[model samples]
Target: MRAIVVTEHGGPEVLHPSEVPAPEPGAGQLAVEVAAAGVNYIDTYHRTGRYPTKPPFTPGVEVAGTVVAVGPGVTGFAAGDLVATADAVGGYAERALVNADRAIAVPAGADLRLAAAALLQGMTAHYLTHSTHPVLPGETVLVHAAAGGMGLLLTQLVKLRGGRVIGTVSTPEKERLAREAGADEVLGYDGFAEAVRDLTGGEGVAAVYDGVGRTTFDGSLAALRRRGVLALYGAASGPVDPVDPMRLAGAGGVYLTRPSLAHYTVTREELAERAGDVLRWVASGELKLHIGRTYPLADARTAHEDLEGRRTTGKLLLIP
Candidate 1:
């Protein structure tokens, strides 16, 4: 099978295409014929060694495809079932192994590309809005990089919960996209904290869904109201520096949480609920997925570069 292997982590140039042995389904896993793989910031992190991994590993984590073989003890899935998972062992390949427990059945007519695009970021949005702080009606919140893949989803989901979104984007085009995604107000990254304060009449927001870590962390903290939550989810620009606990207390008694999707979906039931909602929304057209671009599996390096450069919007996919 052809796969993108990273023997050493340095940059996007390190993601090389190579021939490798196909992965087989082990106990409680399913081997899938890869249809599409989702390109995400985490993949770039893996490539750059920020999130360290052993050498000679594939770099993708989300995939959607048809099952080719089922392992022993796996139930409720067959060789031909359409499935998607955000927890695949190595998705950037012709074939990948997924733990059956973490896999979700795609709806009868759901597009495989959309499924691949929606699972990881979609479920992350789910846990962020539905579980982490639980957006309350009439409350206002801030979302950083509100035109990116995860940002678009977060904006729409926040509106679905009847919350107002004040999004921060880097350009006018991104501001337009964020507004289309239901952001009540969109501002440039420069003076975003002040803009948020002005939008909220000095009350600040109930929460801030921040994915752009280092560049937006202090501003996100500044934009929160008393007892508000700052959910530091991703570090697209760069990882944030260590903070003193006193900053949280001094920032109007705000709460800071560094949450991950893995911790949010610890059980099969939780995974199913989050994935189910996102899948159903996409299938029913209630949640819109904007596919920014598609790259051939071998061009994984370019995909990483485009993503890290912030030149693409919405979800990016790799067709195998």
Candidate 2:
């Protein structure tokens, strides 16, 4: 098997490709012949030691493929099952092992590449819109980086829930994309808070979903209404500074939360439900997935560089 291994924490150069023996599934695991792997920012964090994983490890968590071997004690799955998982490790390889319980069956008509691309980001958007704050009809919400993969999905979900979306983007092209994804108002990152205030008649939005940390954190806080929730889910611009609790109180008693996909789908049942909703929406065409780029597995380094450079939009995939 050919896999990209992170031998040390550093730059994209650290992602070195090598030939190795294929891994066999352990108990309660399935060996998947990887068809596609989602390239996410978290993967870059792992490669750079920002997330603190040990060296000499494969860096991927989401994949979709056919099951080639099922290990002992695994049930509800067999060889040749088309499955996808957001909890699998070593997904940057041609083959990866997935815990059977964590794997979700891809719907018959769903594209495997789309499945892999949407699993993590889709579920993240699901919990953000449905659980974190639960956007209600007539409410207005702010979404940062609203033309990116998660942003587009979040915008669509909020619209489905009847919330009016105000999104921020870095470029005019991204603003158009955000609008197409159902954002009622799209603004440039500069002066977005003031724009949000103006758009909402100075009352502010009901909530703010901010993934671009550091650069937009303060603006997100200012864009919210009294008691509005600010969900900080990523640090695309950079990691935010340590915040004081007083900041929340001063910001109109607004709520603040930092969420991750793992915490949102901790249980197998929860994982299935969230992932199923996302896949169902994709199948029904209610939610569109923009797979902006696809690279061969060996081009993982270039993928990381492009992602970190913010040179691409939508979901990026590595085809194995």
Top candidate by lDDT: 1
Q: What local distance difference test score does each model get?
A: 0.93, 0.92
Span of ten consecutive residues with least summed lDDT in model 2:
106-115
| Model 2 per-residue lDDT tens digits across residues 1-320 | 89999888999999999897899999999999999999998998888888999988999999999999999999999998899998887999999999999999986656899899989999999999999999999899999888888899999999999999988888888888899999998898889899999999999998999988999999999988999999999998889999999999998999999999989899988999999999989988999999989999999999999888888889999998
Q: Write the per-residue lDDT of candidate 1 for residues 167-243, one digit (tens) a residue.
A: 98888889899999999998999999999999999999999999999998999999999999999999998999999
Instruction: Name model 1 segments beyond 4 Å from true.
Output: none
Residue pairs with clashing backbones, model 2: none
lDDT of 2 at 132: 97
Worst 10 residues of 1 by lDDT: 106-115
TM-score of each: 0.98, 0.98
What does the lDDT read for residue 35 in candidate 2? 93
Task: Output the lDDT of residue 68, model 1.
Answer: 99
